[model samples]
Target: MAATAVPVQSRGDLVLADPASPVATVPAAPQILVPATLSTTLDSRPLDLSPLAGPLAKIAQIEAWLGTELIEREEATRVALTALLSGQHAAFIGPPGTAKSLLILLLAQAFDLSKFITLCSPHSKLEDLMGPLRLSQLPHDIYERLTNAYMPASQLVFLDEVFNLSGSLAQTTHRLMNEREFDNGNRVERAPLISVFGASNQIPQTPDSAAFLDRFSFRLWLGYVSRTNFPRLMALYANRPSSAVLRVLAHNMPIFASQHGLLTLAPPPVTLGQDELFSLMWAAAHIPIPQSILSTLDKLYDDLAGKGIYVSDRRWRQSQDALRVNALLDGRGIVTNDDIAVYTNMFWTTREQRVTIAQVVERLGNPLAVAAVDKRDQAKTAYDAAIAAQADTDLDSGRKMNATVEALGKLKETAQSLEALLAQAQQQAMNPTKIQRALDAVQGWRKELSEYVL
Candidate 1:
């Protein structure tokens, strides 16, 4: 058969040699290719990089208002302020007239206008805090105006006598403060609020509710001004009207807020160690801690435990962070022993425990000094009397004299044991590390007691 050239089909069908035969395999479809080297064009515009300015000069003015004599409660105030700036709620508990409301007002002034809201006692309500639904005359129907009427725009909210609100209202406010959102009848609106400062004359004897208490992230105890600061405060009050001072404070608000932020960013200069942790734990365990104090510690411990309450380890890692914040305000980079003492003293606990621990710490070095001296004197007096009696010779027989001496020795041993226990308790406060050493010494002494005839 003569070879015939097969013609390729153009735009029309072509006859094939065999209709049933499989058509030649179609060539593989061509893949659409993308360029590998497409360059990203740069605008080449310079960034408006500007150095951050330090806190406003007004901050210095506020500090000057605070004056050179500082209150013992100032440390607690700083910690509360920092927590507030971090968008955490705090409760300030103390007797009335400790400037708790004034502090909140100052905090409000520190923020820009419209960023701080102050709701004074016995009058604040849920609607006052979260805005109320207004009926517009034009629309002839109710419309929700998320008004910033009483609410501060992008700022903190201070509620004085927070416990005064009705239970339902307080619960609603608590939820909003915690979740940052509120139900406005038809829809939920999230507010720009950051911190909520709640102050009361006294800690609610019975807390409002667990839900309410949980809303606060920090708790602080505000106390009367130190004796050192009292005279200065009195002089300031005597010389200037509170209203005029408030205006000055208002003018310096921005600066104060900026300074506060700067202080917060500064690294915690102090690191709490094992000894500090032990001291804190000892104080916490012994002291009758207020609800507010417990709440604060619980939050701190929760943060440290990574939100788990059942961790096998009890570490004071969170306390280290708190210590650092404390040190930064104190203007130091390294935490000192003094810092630990100061912080341990600040945590709120029962008065009895506070006094006891303070006494223990104060007498750490002299735990046995007074008692040992008295003991020695008594022992000497007894021994001298015993010798004197032996000189008398005929009153009692040798066996009776020996028995009396042995009883005196037992009395001495009892006194010594008591001295050792007192020393151990004192050492536990001053330096927990020395506790084991003291314990070992006590055990050795106890073992020796077994050898005594008594």
Candidate 2:
């Protein structure tokens, strides 16, 4: 049957006869509390931005641009961007010459952000890192730090040798990273921080050090470019853009930029404002995560704990947004097994657990899980839409609401088929939880809609 569009009416309700079904009215629906921005996050529509690389394009563009020069640092760039999308700090731990500092420079240049970049040392002073106090304020009995372009005042920050911070610098940036604020005189000033990307050779194994590291949601292990890629790396370094060339293209290429050079304009910063970044972060927060994958995560965590590998309670909670952000970056609407493959970057706490956790996640991988999850989401969206239509006062008559009633009838048919799919999944010894839940929801919707069936 051909489906007709639901006509908009001015006075009388224009009834839509769904060729698909004869249902003309809907039953009472429960008042669904839609989440605010947060609820929109939970009830977030299936955001499909595979074409546009999602809302975090600026960050994605930075990652891609960095990848052009950074050899064997793909994971580092990816994890770093994921951390930003998750609105959590990240750490890069590797030996010198592993491009930790270089990656920082490239990343900072790839986008135009108010950044505070510092090379940390044992002698690093808080006054130097966050900025020195105003000399004028000292005589007036005010000790305000002039925090312009400093750690507390920046959006994207990079602290190389992060573990070498002096006591005051460490303590202050800790608050800045975690609390998003800085102590200025007797009061604290809110920071416009997105995430702090830190680089370190090693993490000191003290409880205090561990606590500080915990502030970062991800820590990617950087390694030397493999012997196989050594030739390419060497060639890359040989052909690397010199500071002189960069300056010429940036500062001296106004006239010749178009006539004889590929560098047309000075590097146009691929930038996003704080407002847009916050909105993208919120959109990233809404990316769909499936229950089956989450269930697998539950099993993975339990498995890791059994092996004496405990991820922190806080990390456990934050991993959701991280996973969702990973999905958004991969140009997908929902988290998948491919996105979860990056779990190694998130929860690997120790050298041994790194390999062990990878094995565990591999063992728990379910390729069919995403398909089931997606189907369930589709059913849920259909069910929710039907309910919302039933409750809409503007849908005043049978004609006005028939399209939604028809959707309910279609959902009923879908539920009948899903019941069989659930049965087969159960027979296969797979966790049919998602499919079963989806069927139950559609069944519930059908039951309500059937109350008014005539």
Candidate 3:
């Protein structure tokens, strides 16, 4: 497949003047800055993060808790944490039963963030998402959306099958995410939203839909447990088939709490509280884009452009905040080229483009890991295609089954090659973790393919 072109805007400049560096100022958040005083009296003083400390210190515990017994979501867990802690919108894409919903709920539950959750469809209306207008205002010829506890008023939002939204609803959502304000007819109300989360099984290809997705600064791709991780996933859930996080997210807290024969268990690790979250946001906002980091990003932008991947200027600027927070998550005060890997999630608009970004990031982040990452990605794509082929009733079962076997054979060879490369990288004492993930993926996929064969 030919590479798809993403829009490139001239405003994609990355240099930050020394005097105007973000470190010296508290970046403004409209919600806390000059938010509307809803009928709920939401408008008030701006956020002051000066006194807050160690938000990054407590995030690992949060990540570990959310990741408990979840399969193949190590990187997704970090992306979720970064999106939430950095207060940026993100989209999670994966197949059903892949734990996407479970993961988001755990993140939301950990922070106790006020959230509005809904499923989108072709018939979904704006009123369904933002809520009905104030009846009294309608009488006064003012159509004011009563946003109490709705997407516009909540600190976080999770929309399932978000791409199914009707054109009108999608447009309204685009405005709400990009502007952080709702057009109330009589007034433009500042939203209290910290982040808007979206999930889908596939990427949207239409221009408008692409624009809607661009509103999200980061996108995470989740896959099923590989042959390698399947055992771990099963071992963790051997006695119990369903996810504990699923039960909790379903409002079955008591049932979830009592799942084990032992009636009591220690409390799971947690996010410090909403106040602590505010402080983390404050601290993260103050993290500066050092000239060197910006310069690195500039070169990265060009490299991606060379490969026909174009990220909008706005996306890059917004992503910087999240990257800074990623640094913070590592208990670091400075940003590094290592952090550029986060851009891997930000640049791709389609599944095919994802591998390109991965190869690019891995190449720059760790050259030794590139071949492994590329090989593993190619094998996994073939394996995924084979799995998908079996589901297509139009295809000849005999032919498809044989093709799947061939794909599996190739995947096994690739897995062994990845293992060899991983060992070489490890012996060289280069970053082995990257290659390790690749090796795990192909090995797992190879196992998955074998199961399909049987």
lDDT per residue for candidate 3 within 194-248, as digits (tens), equals 8888898878877877778888888988888888567788787676635455545
The list of candidate 2 runs beyond 4 A from truth reads 1-37, 50-60, 241-276, 366-454
- The whole-model lDDT of each prediction reads 0.45, 0.68, 0.71
Q: Residue 36 CA error for candidate 2 (Å)?
A: 9.2
Show where candidate 3 strays beyond 4 Å.
1-53, 241-268, 371-432, 435-454
Backbone collisions counted per model = 2, 2, 1
Q: What is the lDDT of candidate 3?
A: 0.71
Q: What TM-score would you give candidate 2 relative to the actual structure?
A: 0.66
Off by over 4 Å in 1: 1-53, 56-73, 116-124, 137-145, 152-154, 207-211, 226-228, 241-454
Alpha-carbon TM-score of each model against the true structure? 0.45, 0.66, 0.69
Q: List the residue pairs that clash in candidate 3.
A: 227-444
RMSD of every prediction: 23.3, 20.2, 12.0
Better of 1 and 3 by TM-score: 3
How well is each residue in 323-349 modelled by candidate 2, as lDDT tens digits?
Answer: 888777766656765566567777876
